[model samples]
Target: MSLPVLTHCPYCSLQCGMTVAARAEDDGGGWEVEGANFPTNRGGLCEKGRSSAELLAHPDRLTTPLVRDSRREPFREATWDEALDRVATALRDTQQRYGADAAGLFGGGGMTNEKAYQAGKFVRVALRSASIDYNGRFCMSSAAAAATKAFGVDRGMPFPLADIARADTVLLVGSNPGDTMPPAMRWFAAGRERGATHLVVDPRYTASAAAADVHLQPVPGTDLALANGLLHLAIKHRLVDTAYVAERTTGWDAVRRAMRQYWPDRVERITGVPVRVMERAVRLLAESRATMILSGRGAEQHAHGSDTALAWINLALALGLPGRPYSGWATMTGQGNGQGGREHGQKADQLPGYRMLADPAARAHVAAVWGVDPDELPRPGVSAYEMLDRLGTDGGVRALMVMASNVVVSAPRADHVRERLGALDLLVVSDLFLSETAALADVVLPCTQWAEEEGTMTNVEGRVLRRRRAVEAPDGVRSDLDVLADLAGRLGRGQYFSADPQTVFDELRRASAGGKADYAGISWARIEAERGVFWPCPDEDHPGTPRMFRGAGEGAERSSTRGYFATPDGRARFHVVHHREPAETPDGEYPYRLTTGRSRAHYQSGTQTRRTKALLDAEPEPVVEIHPDLAARLGVADGADVLLRSRRGRARMRARLASTIRADTVFAPFHWAGEQTINALTNPALDPASRMPEFKVCAVDITAAPAGEDTTA
Candidate 1:
C-alpha cells in the first residue's frame, strides 16, 4: 500500500498539516485524509475535518451542468459544451448589447489559489465585465483596507503560531481563533496556563472564551468604545510606547489627541463597559512582558468598523505592540489563503500582490504581470452590497456568476437581496450543493470538492499548504476551473486556458509575483518537498517566515530589527462611539434580539457538514438558543416550540433554554433552512465602513409554537 500523502485539512484555517493514507480505486481514482500525525491537530480530527471523505462522495454531488428556463422552472441537465455555449453566448451577447458593466462576476476566496486566480482571469479577460467582487467583503476586506492604510501590510503574522507561544500575552478581540483556528490555540494555552494573560473581548462567550484568563462581555455593537477606553487607560497610565510610536509609525500625535476624547471614564455610557473593567484591561496589556493584540470580524463588522480596527490597532501601537515579537495588531483572516487572495486582486479594488487596483503604478505593474493593457483590468468596482443593491436597475448588473458562495442563506438583508437577485436576467452558481445561492440560479454547475481535486489553500496564518488530489469526483461533476476554461473557449476566447488545475495554478503563481506579497518563490515543487511555506517567498533559496516582526527585550529601547507600526497617524486610533440600537430593534411586536452563529458540529451554513450522516444526525432539527431567564419570562420551558418573527419575516423552531447568551439575546445557527431558519428575522443593515451586515446583532419576537407543533415530547 502507498503511504498517506501529506496534505492540509480541508476544514477551517488552522490549516492543520495532515498525512492521508490512500489506495487506488478500480477506476484509477483515490481518497485521502488525516489518520496520521499533523503538527497542529496531532492524531485528532473535528467532525467537519474527518467527514471530508463522506462529503467528497455525497450522493447529491452535482456531476453535470444544468440550466433552467426561468426563475420558477426546474433545472434540466445539459452537455458541458451546451452549457458553456449558453453561458458564453449570454455573456458575449450581453456585453455587445449592454456594455461591459452589464455583466458581473462574484468570486470567492474559499476557492483554491489556482481557481481564484483563473476565476479573476476569466472575468477580466474572458468576460471583460467591469463588475467583479468576492465574499471577502464579509470576511476581511475592511481589515485589509485598514491594515494596508496603517502598516502597508496585513496578515495573520509575519511570524508563526510559535510566536504566540513565545509571547507573554495575547489580547484577542472580536475573535475565537481557539475554536475557529485550532492550531492557533496551541499558543492560546502557551502561557503556563497563567504566566501570560489571555483576554477575550466579545459580546458572546464563544468557545475561545472558555480558555481565556478574562472574558470581557461587552454589549454587541460597542467594541470601538471598549477599545478606546483601554487606550485611554494606557495613555493615562503612561504606558504609551512613545519611542516605538515616533520612529516606526507616522500618525501618533493626531491619534493621541483623538484618543484623549475617549478617556475610560467618559466611554462607559457609549460602550456599556464599566471604567474599572477598561482600566484592568489596560494594566494587563501594558504590564505584560510581551503582548499581541489580535483583531477579527467582530471588530470589522460594524458601521464604524474601520474606526474600530484603528482603535484596537492603535491600542497596540500605544503599548508599542507592532514590530515586536509579542506585540502587533494582526487581523485574523478566516478563509484559507484569504490573505494571499486579496494580495492577488481577488478583492474588488486590488491588483495582484497587495497592489491597489486604483493606484496607476500598481495597476500598471499588475497589467504587466498579466500581459494585459492597464485599461483591460477595468476601474475599481463597488463593494458587495452595492453590487447586489444595483442588480436589475438602470446601469446595474444584468447577470451575476458566483463561485462557491451561498449568498441566499448567508448575505445580509437576506430577504431583500434574494428578492433583487430573483430579478436578474441570469444567475449562475457553481458549487457542490443546492445552496441558497444555487437554489436561486438559472444554472447550477456542480464542481469538485477539495479532496476530489488538487490545489493549494492559504490558511488564516498565511501558511500556503498543498491540497493533493485524494479521490476522483463522482461522475458527471467537473472541476470549476475546467468549467470556466471550457466556457471561456466556447465563448470564442481563452483557448489557451487549460482544464488542468496545475496549469491554472502556474499562471496564478506568475500573476502573484513581484507585488508587496510576492509568492514568486513558491513552486508546486517546493511545497511538495517542504509540505508548506509561509508566503512573501520572493526567491528560491529562501526559507519561509515562521513568525513575524520581533521586538526588543523588556525595558529596552525598541531595537531596529523588530517590526514597526507605520500608521500615518503615528499612533493608534481611538473611536469613542455611543451605543446605537441595532438597525432593527425588537419592539412590543418583535421582542427578542436574534443572533446567528456556527454550531460546533458544522461550519458556515453546513453546506458540507449537512451532507455527512454523522453530523446531519447530530443536528437533525434546528433549535434556537434562548436565555433561560428570557425563556421563563416567555412562559416557555426546555424543549418547547416557538415562533420567531421580525419586521422582515419569521421562522419556527424548537426553543432551547440555555444560558449560552446574554439574557437579552437569542442564538440561532445559520445552517438550517425553511421554517427553522433564523436569517429570516436578521436585519441586513451593514457596517457603514465594511458594508458587512450585522449578523451579530438583530431583534426578533418569540411566541409559543402553534398547537400542532411539538411544544413537548
Candidate 2:
C-alpha cells in the first residue's frame, strides 16, 4: 500500500487539511481520509471533509463525456475528440454568427488558481470573448467591493484565523460558522476559554449564536442600521479612537454626521433589537482592548450589502480596529477557492493578480506574459447575474461554457435562470457529476475529482495550500486542464494551455507577479515544505505575508500607515450609509419573510455531497424552518408538508417548527434542486455596487400541503 498524500478538504473556504490514503483494488478503489495538523483546523475535520473522499467512488460519478445532436435529443456517450471538436466548433460558430461577447464563459469558485488563471486566459486569447464571470460574484462580491473601496485591497481576511483566538472580543455579524464551517468554531471556543466574549448578530439564533455570550437577533436587512447604532453609542460613550481615526482614516466627518440619525431608540425601532441589547453589544466591543469584526453572506446577500459592510467597517474604525494585532474587519468567504478565484481572473472585471481589466498597464503586463497583443484583449463584461440575464436575448450570450458550477440549483431566482439557460443555442458544462445545470447541457464533460487532481487553493485566511493527487482517476475521465488543452488545440490555440498542473501554476505565478495579489515567491515545492504560504510573497528570498498592513510607516515590510493605501491619497476612506428596506418585503399577499442559507452536512447545490450516503442520511431532504407561532397560525405541525409561495415561484417541503428563528420569518436551505429548490423563491434584485442578488430576503407565504400531495415536489 502507498502512503497517504497530504491535501486539503474540497469543501468550504476553511480548506481543513487532510491526508488521503488510497485503498487496494479488493478493498474498493477509493481513498480513506484522516485529519492533518494544519493551522486552520489543527487536526480536526468536519463531516463534509471526512466524507469527501466518498465521492471518488460514487456510483453516479460521470466517467465519460456525454453529448447530443441538438436540444431535442437525449445525450449519448462520445469520444473525447468528438466532444472537444463539438465544443470548439460551437464556440467558433457562435462568435462568427454573433459577436465575441455572445460566447460567454462561466466558472466556479471551487476551481484552483491554476485552472482559473488558464480559463480566463483561454477565453480572452483563444475565443477572444469579453463575457466571462464566475459564481464568486454571488458569494462575497459586496464585501470585496467594500474592502477595495476602503483599504484599496481585497483579501477576505486581512489577518490570519489565529488572531481570532488572541482577541479580547469578537463581534460576529450575520455569520454562523458553527454550521457552515464547523472546524472554524474551534478558534472561537479557544477564545472563549481565554476570557474572550463572542457577540453574534443574526435574525436566527444559529448554532454560533446559541454559544455566544450575547446574541443580538435583529430584523433581517437592518444590519447596516444596527452597525450605525453601535457606532453612535460608541461615539456617545466616548469610545471613539480619535488618534487612530484622525491619523489613519479619511472621511470620518461625513460618517459621524450620518450616525446621528441611528440613535439607539430609532435603531431599536428599525432592527427590532432592544435598545439595551444594542447598547450592551456596543459596549462589549468598545471596552475590549482588542476586537475582531467578521461577517458572512447574511450581511452580504442583500440589496444594500456594500453599504451594510461599510457600516460594519465604520464601526470597526470607530473602535480603532484596523492595523492592530488581533483587531480588524474580515469576511468569511464561503467557497473553497473563493478568495483566490476572484483574485486571479474568474471575475468578469479582473485580470490575473487581482488587476482591473480596464487598466492599460495591467492589460499590457498580462498581455506580454500571454504573448498576445494588448489591443486584442477584450474589455470587461457584465457580471454573473447580468450575463445570465442576457442569455438567449437579441445580441446577448448565445453560447455558454460552464466549468465546475451548478447554476440552476445555486443562482437566485433559479427558475428564471433555468429558463434563460434553456433558451441558449449551445450549453456546455464540465463537472464531476451530472448536476441540474448539466442535465440541460448540449455537452457534458466529465472532469477529475479533488483526490484525483493536483492543484492549489487559497483558504479563507489567504493562505494558499496545495492539493495533491492521491488516487488515480477512472479510465476515460480527464482533468479540466486536459479538457481545456484539448479544446484549445482543437481551436488552434494549443500553445497557450498545458495539461500539467505544475506548468500551469508556473505560468500563473509569472502572470500574477508585481500585481496586488502577488504570488511570484510561492511555488508547489514551497507549499509542500511549509504546509502553506500566504500571498504578497514577491520574490525568492521574501517571506510569505501571513498578516497584512503590519508596518507602521512607509518603506516598512507591511505598511499600514498613511500614504500606503492603494487609493490616490494612500488613506483609508469611509462611506456614510443609512438603512434601507430590502428589494422584497413581506406584504398582504406574501406575509412571511423568507431567508435561505446552507446546512451543516451539505454544501452548495448538494451536487457532490448528496451523492454520499452518510451525508445524505444526516440531512436527507430540505425543510422550511418556521417559528412555532407562525406554524400554529398557519395550521401546520412539525414535519407537516408545506407549500411556500413567493412572487417568483413556489417550493414544497416539510415544515420544521422552531423558536430559534423569528416569528415573522422563515428559513430554508438552498442545497436541493427541482421542486425543492429554495433559490427559486429567492429575490434576484442585484445590489447596485456589487451586483450581488438579494438571496437572504424575499417575501413568501406558507400553506400546509393538501392530503395525498407529494411534499417532495
Which residue pairs come into collision in candidate 2?
551-558
Per-residue lDDT of model 1, residues 96-192, tens digit only = 8778877888877678887877776677767766687777776786676666666656665555655676678788888887556655676667764
lDDT of 2 at 160: 83
TM-score of 2: 0.98
Task: Flag regions of model 1 displaced more than 4 Å.
Answer: 22-32, 39-43, 192-194, 550-592, 707-713
Best by lDDT: 2
Please give the CA lDDT of all the candidate structures: 0.71, 0.90
Q: Model 2: per-residue lDDT, tens digit, 1-713?
A: 46988888999999999999977878866678999999999989999999988887888989999999988899999998898888899898988989888898899999998889888988898888898999999998999999988888888998789889999999999999999999999999999999999999999999999989999988899999999999999989999999988877899999999888988899999999999998888888988988999999999999899999999999988788887778889999999999999988878889998899999999999999888899999999899999998899987899999998999999988889999999998999999999999999999999998888999999999998998888889998998888888888888888877889999888889989988888899999999888889887887687787777654552334732236455667767888888999998889999999988999999998999889989999999989999999999999999998999898888889999999999999999999988899998999899999999999999998999886776434
Runs with alpha carbons beyond 4 Å of true place in candidate 2: 24-29, 553-557, 560-564, 708-713
